[model samples]
Target: MPRRHLHVTGAAEAPLRAALRALRTELAVPDAFPLQVLVEAEHAAKAPRLPSYDATDLPLFTIDPPTSTDLDQAMHLSRRPGSGSASGAGPGGYRVRYAIADVAAFVTPGSALDAEAHRRVSTLYFPDGKVPLHPACLSEGAASLLPAHTCPAVLWTLDLDADGRTESVDVRRALVRSRAKLNYAGVQKEIDAGTAEEPLALLKEIGQLRERLEVERGGISLTIPEQEITEHADGETGGGTYELTYRAPLPADGWNAQISLLTGMAAADLMLAHGNGVLRTLPAAPDGAVGRLRRTAEALRIDWPHHVSYARLIRSLDPHDPRHAAFLQECTTLLRGAHYTPFRDGDLPTITTHSAVAAPYTHCTAPLRRLVDRYASEICLAAVAGTPTPDWVLAAFDTLPDEMTEGGRRAGRVERECVDLVEAALLRDRVGEVFEGFVVDVEDVEDVEDANEDQPVTGTVQLESPAVVGRVTGTPGTPLPLGERLRVRLTQSEPGAAKVRFVPVVPVDPVDPA
Candidate 1:
């Protein structure tokens, strides 16, 4: 019998549709709040004070996606002999000056904008559009690091050694104007072609230096291909799925590493110098992740060094190969959770702090989009200015560990709901059909254990395609390794319940033998 495409209808809607909609509505604040009242209170509390701007003459430029509007940062570079080195100011040690828009300049304390910003906490990124923090007048205009417009900014001047490690960090208030606004793809092309412009040339140089620094410092990084959906004008997918694979090339990775190295260095300096502040995303290492990966390697006949960093292996895995895809899925078990913490004058506790960055770092980038960044940036500012951290910022630090976590949970729910809706809608008609699948799990319907030994009493396995995890009924055979492949017939799929069940189609001989 010819298999027809499943056309599953929702119970009027996906189960999570209502829940997601409710959460979004609950979390979303009006785009703009009346500032007259807040502004008056702000002015009454403190007179307008602005940071010094001095880079207007230099052609600082911003390169972001074409659709990007909340431009938060701009950059320019100048090369000279390392102050004392004899490189003669030509292709010598370079200075990377990143001009971050001084958002604190406009959003004064105890004002309407500040209150609204606090309430919203962070910008929400949705598939269709984004919910911005400040209005366009500021986030996209005055406070934006737009091209050719001199703007007030908090400048970070990093002195790099021949390697990318910062010899010193010079933070100051400056006035700067950008030369051009470019995007990642364009800059990538320019780098690849080797015909680099003013900014691209600097980016290439710094990026190379940073890459070497990371490798030397025992850092592990991965280049995963992310898939994005785009509009397809012709065919069955006129509005179908299109996957976007981004090669985080040397240039991009280098650029990112430079930023990470700088931020991590800065964060370390601050934490050492000051007694207290909040650090972002520190998850305790997942227990038994290594053992599980070792088992996975043995089962799949893949050679992974037991002592080698998992991140390094992931980076080397070929994205184009089928085994790599399956291996990537298996590796997901080893990836641990992340967290935010408040620290006082004490030894830097050994914790899982940004495994990807391989550094003790905090969220200080993208303040407009991340709530923690805004708060952390303020902490950086206060520490830099040598003033007591503001009461509000301190309060935020205390409350954030919960609020942000809750916010993230809500965001995850919404995203998962959307994905489920799309997948259920796609698989509506394919009931009872058997498909080749990887065995991600074989556990009891209750008491599922995690890497940390915490038992999540649920019979579930996460799948790749439709990309979901749900409860399963039968407990296949023992010694069934997680992430093993098998043929399973989709017995039933309940869109309303957001449920999917699979029955193992027993094979004459074990299909996936090591």
Candidate 2:
């Protein structure tokens, strides 16, 4: 589940834009903020409840998409000398200084902003734009870790061994200023060219070590290209246009993510040690979803040995390969099992780990965009301080699971609809043309999920040219092959409804009578 970015290239965009607007209206997605919320945000922006400690001299830097403004987390990476103690710096290990935006400092508990954040639960992202969780005055201004701006942050100091095993951790409130706001491509360019500063260079080293550590721990961090929408202008061409394409995942993206993952794991360990906190958990992917992924891999012509775990297969993939990219996109289904779960009084949930992470994890990062992170960050801060978890946070935990679950559902719908709208728009004129596709899914394992009263036939087909997946219908009782190449014709491409359909092109019989 990768987030999509929108850029400007050129295509007729009115219809798709109108459809997206309609979808937003239909979903009753929150639009402009109420007057009171905006007023409170602006007031809080000028006078935030600043933390006592100051660490702006740490020279932390942030990594995000270049256009990002709601900066949440920043970090400074360096090595610690050996102390010889098991819990001390493990023989010239590393230290990660992570600064997370202290959203709680601005949004007081039980205030309008807090209530609105709880209502929204999380930010909703679409290719066109994103519905932010907080007003821009704070999320993008006072609370953001934008370069040259001192912001209140929950700074984490994590000590790791030479092989990337965490040795110790410390978390506290501090004021931080990011030295630079960097992007993946820029960082990668610097690292590859041997011009990266010590911290940037250390990122490549530690990120690779963390990746190896992740695989050994049974994690599956997939590298999937995000669908990008950009508009192109001719300078004289006034008509609005757009283009949709996938941006291949870069090594820098993975490296940056590993640092975030490292912090989350550290947060989880802290919460578990304290015996009170909420965790971002995921149950194991269902059999059906895994089977679908297997079919997708075969369709991509990638061999999957029966004994090779999907995690291993995913790790072996070269994400730049278009076939691998398609298969990775299909992994969104595998990630559907994720959710937030709260625990307290030394009671942990039955499933405390994310299946994909293969370890206990918590969302203590990205508070500017995610609701749970704020809550989780508060718990960690109070925990390290040896204070009781806030009463309000404990009260909110009762409903955090349900609220975040609903938020995730809305996000999933938005991602799916946007992809569907783009696919339909791109294929609208290609109806009736036969295209090669792979049968990546059957209707359902036990029965046809889209069965009509008269006939039962439907499955998902993946088209290669444009990376479109649609319902592939066939004659009565003829279940689509699970993993076979087939000829399919686009039958319906309605951008307005975000609908697309395909039918298998049944080969005609020749010379029937002898």
Q: What do the candidate models score in CA lDDT, each in turn?
A: 0.57, 0.82
Best of the candidates, lDDT: 2
lDDT of 1 by residue, 62-124 (tens): 766676777777777766564543334334566777777776766666667776666666665
Q: Which tens-of-lDDT digit does each residue in 363-427 have in candidate 2?
A: 88899888999989988987888888888889998788898889878887887787787778778
Give the lDDT of residue 366 in candidate 2.
Answer: 90
Best by TM-score: 2
Model 2: CA > 4 A from native: 7-13, 83-91, 233-239, 285-301, 321-323, 433-439, 449-457, 475-487, 505-514
RMSD for all candidates, in order, please. 7.0, 4.2
Q: Would you give me the overall lDDT of model 2?
A: 0.82
Where does candidate 2 clash, by residue pair?
7-229, 7-230, 7-231, 8-230, 8-231, 8-232, 9-230, 9-231, 9-232, 11-242
Q: Judge candidate 1 against the unseen true structure and give its global Cα lDDT, from 0 to 1.
A: 0.57
Q: Which runs of model 1 end up more than 4 angstroms from their true locations?
A: 1-49, 82-91, 231-254, 281-287, 325-337, 344-356, 382-392, 426-475, 478-514
